[model samples]
Target: MRVTLPLLALGALLLSTGCSGAEEDAAPPPATPAQDGPAEHVFAPGEQITADLTMYDGDDGRRTPFFSGYRPTIEFRHGGLSGECGVRLPVELREFPPGETHTVVLECGTEVVVPADDRGFALVEDGVERGTGEVVLTGEG
Candidate 1:
């Protein structure tokens, strides 16, 4: 009789523990959707644009712009009467001395001339724009 009581207690303890563990191991709830909308814009063919960049280093006693270490990408966007157009330009600059300022021309062309005021340009890195700059768009032959 005494042994029976001890066995009953042990069985009850095991059952309670098993049930609690099952509850803890249940699957988590579904993930919620993103709050912010789409971060990137998709461009149509022929509507895409490109830009030419002339990088100039000022005499502010700063280090010369290094291009060999990193590849710089530029995205130009314009809002006009027709619609909005954007282009990405990849740039590479050779290493220069800290005291010297160098200029490199990037060849970029589009069907239309983006107005100076309506034009917006950005330096892209890792899918994100690191800095902002002005670029002149030229016509292609």
Candidate 2:
């Protein structure tokens, strides 16, 4: 009887600690911004643009530099109006002066020309204009 009681207690303890492992995991509850994850930042257009330029190939999820030793600025433009987007790891590596300009050819056979700054720029894919964009450099900046 004593052993049975101990085993029962152990089982209860395990269950309380979520050790049953029988149910599929559910989506986590929403957490505070500083609690478990970063606070989401919605991209706003004409939002005093100041950031790095990057290239993202949504087709194959390849975010690589156009050339092995090249680091072109990350800017964009597609078939429609301009907008903003968030960047992740594997960004442009080459550094440039804040007000300089450079051109780079993406591995996807795209030719891009734009400012080396994080502001407005043009993205030409292998000489062909893109169909979409995260945030395009618009106007005559």
Output the number of the TM-score-best candidate.
1
Q: Which residue runs of candidate 2 sit more than 4 Å off their true CA positions?
A: 21-46, 51-141
Q: Each candidate's TM vs. the true structure?
A: 0.29, 0.23
33-86: candidate 1 lDDT, tens digit per residue: 764432333334345344433333343322445443234555656643122233
Tell me the tens digit of each residue's lDDT in model 2 across 1-141.
989999999899989997874775777888856443222222333233333343444453234343333322334432222222222323473542223333322222233233323224444444433222232333431
Indicate the residue-level lDDT of 73 in model 2: 32
